[model samples]
Target: MRLAFSLFVAGFVTLAAPVAAQSPDPVAPVKEVMDVTVTNWSDSVDEWKGIFEGDRLNRLYTKELVELYKKASEKAAKIFESEEPVDPFDYDVVTNSQDGCPLQDVKIALAGEKDGVSDVAVSFRLWACEDNADTKNLVSEVHFDVVQEDGKAVIRDIHHVADGERDSVIEELKAIIAQEE
Candidate 1:
């Protein structure tokens, strides 16, 4: 469909042969992002908050989460700052404070786990903004994939799914694969 649309546009431009090569470039191609409307995002809010702000967040990771975080952290440390978000590929949590806009809603859909692999769907209202402050609904579908490690109930492989954010929780993976008990 995209190819067909581009061909049609080209045909029209050629048939209408503009008089000036200097004519301001025709309307620029608009980049479109998704608009998400999320509700009941509060449940994850606490979880997220704890993960971000909690000093001992690692302690709650049913064992598996700890490993995942460690692996992810290790991979991330090789590339980004420790304080930066674990999911560095555009991973951000929205705030409730914003202009007169719709409430910040993030609808998270979690898939059951089996054989150490689980899927989570994050449906939310991504508020469009000039900066991170203008918060407005702009995205609708967000998904995450998690993998469990041996003898652990936590997730080690954290994949956002939307973007190729394949990062292992550094410390966790190291603990598992590292030598010398």
Candidate 2:
């Protein structure tokens, strides 16, 4: 009887161990569009701040934007390389148009997520709290249009909040490129 009980206990432990190992954890990886949008602001606030302070634009910018910036810089270079004097403002790259992340030391909060649109809105607040939050002191709100390109959610455009109006930085760049052509 003792030998039979030991065999049964060993078999039960082996069976339960595999089941426990296969269970998924409660934590989640940031894969979806919404998750990427939030993580970019929350996990990268300091990095964004650095960019605002004249640091290089990293992976946060979309490929389209980066290419446009390159083209704009090339155009400026060619113009400046000529004997004609160039106005600094007239021959500047689009990326240099804005200085860093619009908000400073603010907590990024998800405002909403829309289905089928792949657009996410995020609000930058002064600080975060579990309860009794204040809404009047919001730093700024920004809209992100994300697209899955090459298995990654890239920021296509940023609709920055300015003076109660929203402006798309990408759209502005496109217009500038168009005018130059």
Candidate 2 residues 1-181, lDDT tens each?
9999999999998887755333221111112332333333453444322221122333445578666655554555565684442222331121222322323333333344465225455545423332444533445565666655554455566676667887776676566456542
Best candidate, lDDT-wise?
A: 2
lDDT computed for candidate 1? 0.40
TM-score of 1: 0.35
Clashes of each: 32, 1
The deviation in Å at residue 155 for candidate 1 is 3.5
lDDT of 2: 0.46
lDDT of 1 by residue, 87-164 (tens): 422233222222323334545555555664455555545454335653454554433444433333332333333354
Q: Pick the candidate with the highest TM-score.
A: 2
